[model samples]
Target: MNYEIIINSIASIGVILSVIFLAYQIKKNTQASRANYYDSLNKTNMEFLRQLVENRELGELLEKATSNWDNLNEDDKRTSNYLFIQLFRHWENMFYQHKLSVLDKQLWTNHLNTMIGYFHHDGTQEWWLKRKMAFAKDFRDFLEKTEKPKQIYPTIKDLTIKNK
Candidate 1:
């Protein structure tokens, strides 16, 4: 009977240790998933930026769309509008994921704030005005409720000067 008791106690300890190790593993997996989510988001955003840098025509269309929509020719307008829709679709996915708590709050908010900053432009604002209703209602509601930036994000030079 004593031997049985000792055996049971050892088994109990083992079970407890297993539970603790599983808990640690669960936590680690959760963290890794979060890291991966943010990494994917970064990659998507970087690709968009890279496209703007590498394609001169795309870069010019984006500039014209943001600064003066009227300056665009018919082809430019079609291209600009297409690009804006694609960009917004990406952001809408981010918004939906963030709403579902799939995204880390701080990371999502950082990206959201930068996107909202871009929406401050007249051309983007006009596009949103025309097409806001076409998006998912929940995503549209979130965008409508969030505060947009009053001014465009500053250039790197501006940031450098301000930090000095």
Candidate 2:
């Protein structure tokens, strides 16, 4: 009878130990998952900030190029056109990747139209300056109109905040 009682006690202790170990493993896995999720969210937010700065810089460069139309040498003009085209393509790539807002796409389209308008009037350098100013105004309007989402979703916020 004593032998049976010892065996039962040993079995009960073993079961209790196994349950404790399993619970600990589950807790560790949960923590690791939370860490990974937060890390990923941080990386994404960083990328978005970086991309926004880059896009804004590109927009400024295009605006500068448009302003220099009167003084630009033929080669400089060609280079400017090439750079603007490349910027447009990059903007399109970002849009397709879902990294840019829809309003951004419309803003870029307005710039493209303005560029087309410049070339469309090939004969007259006289109207170039006026046309450029008009385009700039259109671009400013676009900037004023496009609004960013104030706060990301709670899931995104939860992931962004560091685990305690």
Candidate 3:
């Protein structure tokens, strides 16, 4: 009977240890998956920035539209609107992901601050104010609540001026 009791105790201990080990492994795997998700988002963001950097025409359109929308002709306005739609669509995805808790809080907040800076730029506010209906309602509400920061990012013109 004593031997049986010892055997049972050992088996119970073994089972408990196995459970703990599995839990630890699961935790590590979850962390790794989250890291991978963040990396993927970073890559997508970098690709968009790369397109802005490498393609001067796109940069010029964005620059002209954002800073001087009042001066663009009808064709330029349409083109600029198209360009901004492409840019902001990706941003919309990021915003939703953050809202769903897929993105880390601090990372999303930093991105949000950057967006506030963009909103404060010359013509961006006007553009968004008119085009706000195209985005998700919650996102539109978020933008409404966000106070535009005093400082804006350097315009695309500034970055591309060296190339010219």
Candidate 4:
């Protein structure tokens, strides 16, 4: 009778330990899934922004040129300004979501400053405005050159290997 009681106690403890281990595994898997979801979202956002910058058509440039700050028709000005602000907001969100470093932030700030200078210039007619637009195009090229490809898989695998 004593032997049977000891065996039953040990079996119960083993079952409880297994249950605890499974729960911990499930929790870890859940956290990893959440992180991957956020990372996918971040990558999608960056790709969308890059595509927009790359695919700006000539018609869009003409539209921007027509809608001058000084002489914009009210509705034209409103829409242009709204779009500009939204782009700026997206840029800022990307910067934070991607965990950009101080150097990256400085580079982005310089790009913004260049645009601001064009916006504030008093003599920005079609000729100078076109130059400014070219400047923007060049900046977009620079960003494309600088952006690192997403390497989440290899990075995570290396980390796991290191731990083991």
TM-score per candidate, chains pooled: 0.79, 0.36, 0.77, 0.36
lDDT of 2 by residue, 1-164 (tens): 99999999999999999999999999999777656644654465466446537887543444445444556566656655665444434434433433333234554465445334433332223223343343335443443344432432222224455453
In candidate 1, the residue pairs with backbone N, CA or C atoms under 3 Å apart (3 or more residues apart, or in different chains) clash, namely none
| Residue runs of model 3 more than 4 Å from their true location after superposition | 1-8, 156-164
The true-versus-predicted C-alpha distance at residue 76 of model 3, in Å, is 2.7
RMSD (CA, Å), candidate 2 to true, equals 16.9
* TM-score attained by model 2: 0.36
In angstroms, give how far residue 76 of model 2 lies from its true place: 26
RMSD of each: 3.9, 16.9, 3.4, 16.0
Candidate 2 Cα outliers beyond 4 Å, as residue runs: 57-164
Query: What's the lDDT for residue 20 in model 2?
Result: 100
- Worst lDDT run of 10 residues, candidate 3, spans 148-157
lDDT of each: 0.80, 0.48, 0.80, 0.49
Q: Give the per-residue lDDT digits (tens) of candidate 1, residues 14-132.
A: 99999999999999998898788778878888998899899977876786686566667889888888888878888998998887788878878788877787677667777778778
- Per-residue lDDT for 40-66 in model 3, tens only? 878978887788689877767778888
